[model samples]
Target: MQLLALGINHHTAPVALRERVAFPLEKIKPALATLRSIWTSGSPEAAILSTCNRTELYCAVEGKASHETALEWLSDFHGVDVSHLAPHVYALPQSDAVRHAFRVASGLDSMVLGETQILGQLKDAVRTASEAGALGTYLHQLFQRTFAVAKEVRGQTEIGAHSVSMAAAAVRLAERLFEDIARQKVLFIGAGEMIELCATHFAARRPAELVVANRSAERGTRLAERFGGRAIALSELPNRLHEFDIVVSCTASTLPIIGLGAVERALRARRRRPVFMVDLAVPRDIEPEVSALEDIYLYTVDDLGAVVREGNAARQAAVTQAEAIIENRVDHFMQWLDARNVVPVIRSLHTQADEIRRTELDRASKMLARGDDPQVVLAALSQALTNKFMHGPTHALNHARGETRDQLLSLVPTLLRQPER
Candidate 1:
């Protein structure tokens, strides 16, 4: 089986398509189980990495399993038409697959050119695959090497320096909507890492009031207390939504938490005052229809891509350095994969040698059992083992004709070379 990476990312598809294919954290394990079932013949190894910007499947698949099969499987699982999804999908086989994994782990493939969040997301994906029993020797080795390469790139290059984080981009975009962030009351709708990050950036501006609303009130309170703010349950959003001028949401809910009607009510409550809203969730925390509302400035994860892509020009040198490091590691990983190919041949050779030794030892043991001269039996056994070991190469060398003979004449000695004292 060979390594294969096939999927769509922010570079290949729009948010509408990406969100359709995205597997949430809770669904990844089942998705992996289903993918492995599709390739029953290969005993396939599969891992899925799903984030706000991308959803990718990495697999080790054997013969007769092409990208078409995987694409069809994905389309069926997500209920998307193959015709529409195929154009945005990419399939990288063997070395290309290895290279892609390395680049993704090292942050070269992220929408935000040196973002570190993807590495953590990848680790979570790999861990999920492991729990699901989808990670075999090949995929396990691939991710381990991928993580190592990512660490090396981070250590050797300044790719993350001067980088524009999504949180910072959200803040910059919010600044354009409001004259002063300090005068605005901000509500963060999730207490996850992304929410924490957004809170940090927004807090730097010292907003008038900061609040956190989460499904788990305790977790929300803990996160809010960090910024000297109070927490509220998600149930309170409808009643309290209009109180905040800016809202940033990133929750794991599969459905839209903030609908058009809710936002409309909030706008009406504020007498049509403009509410700047950012939805950083994958499936989207806010309804897409809400963007059509006249008095609301709503942005999804895709909307922030342009903002985060800015200010990356100065990091180009570090990007190049990181790419170079990834390429070198990719080559090393491919070499290791190549070595794995010869393992069966090496095993067969050892098996043959062991069989020959057993046959010769049986004959020698019979000689000793019959009371034959001990030294003579020992000599015969030693000679027999040596002859058997050399027989194949000697016969091949003797029978080979012309150039083949010359090649074997040169190769046989190396194959049977003795260790130096």
Candidate 2:
């Protein structure tokens, strides 16, 4: 079987195309099952890692499997145009796949250089695949090593220190717009991890009023209570949006929830007070057109990439250390995979040796049954076994001529060497 990693990410594709190929949370298991079905023989073991910034499919497949087939399946599943995605899609094989997985799990591949959330996302993806019975030895080993590499990178380097995360970046940008964040009202849409993170950062400044708006009031209320804030139904955004100076939204809705008209009305309600908005959702909870309006500052997931990348030069020392750790781990994993290459040959050798042993034992048992002397029969058995073991090499060496004979002469002793006493 061949190891493969195939997908697209922020560097290779724009958000417009990235969102097009995203796999829904509930569809991951079924998608893995379907991915396995395409194989003509036993299904390939597979797992998928889909996050806001990337979607990657890792699989251990038969050599006959086609990369194009897997690519087409992704495009078909997401209702995306294969032609458009083909340009951005990448396929990594063998050691490259091993290295890519290691890099990704270590946070070196994230949009924000050393963010740790990707590691958690990857763990969740692997768990889902395991629960779906889609992971086998090859992929299981690869991911296990990936996690080890990540831990090594984290423990051995300061890669995550001094790095600006998207959540932190949002707060920094908010600070630039408002003189005192503690005096401004902050509203967070959605109760997901990103929202919780942004809320934590905003709450640290003790915003005058903090609110969480979510489709599920129960969840929203739970998160709000933890941060000393209030919860509101998503439906109340139109009326309440005007009260908050900073609005940070991240929801799972496939379409824009906050449109330009909604913001226009909210602006009028505030008498055109400046409002800072961050749309962290992939499909975008807030509409892009809202940025065109005066007295409104709108930012999307892509927009934060630049802000979060600040002080990248300072992180270079940590990056260099982390990369060295990953490189060593990749070498170790590749060596394990390379050892698997000779497994079939090893199995075949055992099978052949076992047959020879059984044949010799049967002959000795028959002679003893015929009333032959035990000592003679045992001696004959040992000689017969030795001759049989040596026959093939003897025949080849004697028959080989010139250079071939010389080569056989040099190799035979090595192949059938006797250990020194």
Indicate which candidate wins on lDDT.
Answer: 1
* TM-score attained by model 1: 0.89
Task: Please write out the lDDT profile of model 1 over residues 233-349, one tens digit for every residue.
Answer: 899999999999999999988888898888889999999989999999888889899999998999888889899887878889998898888888888988898898789889999
Off by over 4 Å in 1: 62-65, 360-416, 419-421
Q: What global local distance difference test value does model 1 have? A: 0.91
Clashing residue pairs for model 2: none
Tens digits of lDDT, candidate 2, 292-384: 999999988788888877757788899999988888888988888878767978999889888998999999999999999999999999999
Clashes of 2: 0
**Which pairs in model 1 have colliding backbones?**
none
TM-score of each: 0.89, 0.90
Error of 1 at 264 (Å): 2.2
lDDT of 2 at 381: 93
Q: Output the lDDT of residue 369, model 1.
A: 98
Per-prediction tally of clashes = 0, 0
